[model samples]
Target: MSKTKSPIELYTKEYYAACTLGGIVACGPTHSSVTPLDLIKCRLQVDPTLYRSNTSGIIQILKKEGLGKLFTGVGATCIGYSLQGAGKYGGYELFKRLYSTHLVKDEATAYKYRTSIYLLSSATAEFFADIMLCPFEAIKVKQQTTMPPWCNNVIEGWKKMYAKEGLNGFYKGITPLWCRQIPYTMCKFTSFERIVEAIYARLPTKKSEMSALQQISVSFVGGYMAGILCAIVSHPADVMVSKINNERKVNESMNVALKRIYSRIGFVGLWNGLPVRILMIGTLTSFQWLIYDSFKAYVGLPTSG
Candidate 1:
């Protein structure tokens, strides 16, 4: 058998661009659509005494604020996610290449070290991404949790926060953002790669010989595994994001607040809006890979394995 040139071998630059664009497009919509679930999750985390249960909190929002209110900060969610996608996917590619050059000396050792590289690269990328995300997240939280109409949009929301609380307002929940994002990105990117590799290895035919359908199926499975793990591992920090973003004040530190939220709500409370989140992550994640690959192909770019 003769060696076939890999997609990445064909058009590296185009492939990288596609990956970045696909990440933005896919994640933007996914994050926006799930804003309501996020709102409910955050509310429960901040004031367990008020929210009590996810179902009840959702119902209450619908009753008082109407269904549209649930999507209050969707615009911010989209913008924030778009930035995050660029940083995440583009940064991953850049860092992956860097690590491959400096860390992995040969194919024999690639598999063993590849996931670790992904974890490190993704976490680093997410740290910067979350900083860009913090202000938007803060505004989104305020808007979602029954803020006044004047504070409806991002600009006004930021103004209001700054006027009242100053620069510290933007960074109020940043610790939680770091906590949630670093682990989430680590699991999301690393696990996706690992799972895809494992599946391809198990296939009857060599991965290089598999059709597009097989590739997509593998992508879906990999994305699901990554999403589930990301969701579970990041739930605690997620609770923190919700709590700090929504509440005016609670006489407790961040860790104390987290413990209180968990103690009041228990394990189930930690996963308050998990059903919607799972659906959100699974569908978007699967489509993200498909879109990224398709876009790369369209642009005559090389595919990254």
Candidate 2:
């Protein structure tokens, strides 16, 4: 039998690629599946008067726009998240290495400050991941927020935005995307690590002795718990991202847009649509970690990598 590699050797360039691919497999399909819920979430944020509660919003959308409307921008969700997954998972692994080697001095320090390392690494990875996701997210929000007679799909939206505002148009919400995703991602990664650590610590048997399904269930629990924090931390900026992307003005800065939105909706409004989001994000994030971990196991790679 071959000898097992150390953690340092286990997470190599190819390991990162596997993690990136696993991220794509995990995030893309799961996010696309929730397009309908996400569509309603955006509508509630952008036009609360019209959309109202989640139940009312769904009924109204089905009645007025039909089934097709609920799936608006799903293509953007899949494609954009697939790309962002590469940046997020792959970059997280890369940043983890950077933090371990350059930032954390020695192994003992690394172990002592692992939580801080997770936070910094997750934040750095999410920053670049959001950059990749921003344009596609802009397209998705625009399609979801604007009613009929808007760009029909991701391709059409890309073309239209290019014609209307050029390359800069696509990146309209990068700032808010960063603001929204960074904190959310930081919470996600850090919480997941801590929760998993907690679980293994509490478990009488070693993780290796647990069944594969048991391991996956633990991952799912950690992910869902993390997602609650993810949604709460990210909701306000998420609202701003949708609003900014759908702006009608010619030259609106982030502050101008934020001020206008805050005036329109106060602190309470920022948390609108959160109940539905809790259900949606909780389930979504759980499945993301489940699928990602499953994928890694299937490919014979370390799940954490």
Candidate 3:
């Protein structure tokens, strides 16, 4: 008789699916819910002179475009981020596992090298995640910056760009995206890991003794703390991506676009949307970790802090 798979094998597919689904649910709807904030953030980044604050930015958009205008590019934001989440969380797990096998050592040794592993694994995953994100992100930025909004939805935006500018138009900001996302993700995973370790190290009780809710709360704290750093680290390149997509010509080189955007506003302008970004990213990252780790545990996989 054929031997049955072990317990881990019994739910392997289901558990892995949950890993990806957790990230999708965590990031996609959360990002869509913050569409107004993101829309304002983008405007502040590209045209700070026009928008002095979030409140004023919303008022301007409403007066000029209407309430529906606030949701421009939200569809692309959701779909694109869902794809990115899958690549990020799924790829992180894949690369981390692969690297762990090579770095095989005692638990203490692993902890000693934790930060390096986290950084390298995060960078690998983000590379794949950015590939999924760039096209949709390009579409979203175009829609957000275009007068009266560029297209009705992601599909329309993609179609219009493909017809007009071809494939190159959809990925013009990929380089800046990597520049922004790589550091952001590295800080995200590493800081979250370290923060969680610090928080737990002081606890009277062990992690295994804590209830699931308590574990999730710990993850929230770490993820939020990490996210603040993530926003700060990534803001400059975030500005570059926004400015590049908004003002770049059909055949314009990224270097020329970068020089022009920076020349007009200079270095300080790159941080225009930082406060709003901190709030948005902090909460988003916290919940994403809470949901992602909770799902991993529920599906019988190893949990992280």
lDDT (CA) for every model shown? 0.73, 0.84, 0.84
1-305: candidate 1 lDDT, tens digit per residue: 12345445522675566667866876777778777777776555555566656677678878988988877788888988888887787778777777767788876686677878888888888888888888888888777665443377888888898998888888888898899889988988888888888887888987667655566667767777778778778877786677667763634466776666567768766666566566556666666766665555454453345
Clashing pairs in 3: none
Each prediction's RMSD over C-alphas, in Å, is 3.8, 2.4, 3.8
Q: Candidate 3, which ten residues in sequence have the lowest lDDT sum?
A: 1-10
TM-score of each: 0.83, 0.94, 0.92
Candidate 2 regions exceeding 4 Å error are 1-9
- Residues 185-287, candidate 3: write the lDDT tens digits: 9899889989999999999988878777788889989999999999999999998889888888888888888888889989898898999899889988888
Please identify model 1 stretches exceeding 4 Å from their true place. Answer: 1-15, 47-63, 147-150, 248-271, 302-305
Q: Order of all candidates by lDDT, from best down to worst?
A: 3, 2, 1
Clashes of each: 3, 0, 0
lDDT of 2 by residue, 1-305 (tens): 11244333456777788888888898899999999899988888877787667788788888998978879999999999988888887788789888988986799999899999999999999998888898899899988888783788888999999999999898878888898889989998999989998988899987777666678888989999989989988988888888778873557877888888788888888887788788788888899999988877666655551
Highest TM-score: which candidate? 2
TM for candidate 3 is: 0.92
What is the TM-score ranking, best to worst? Answer: 2, 3, 1
* Cα-based lDDT at residue 277, candidate 3: 93
Position 218, candidate 2: lDDT: 86
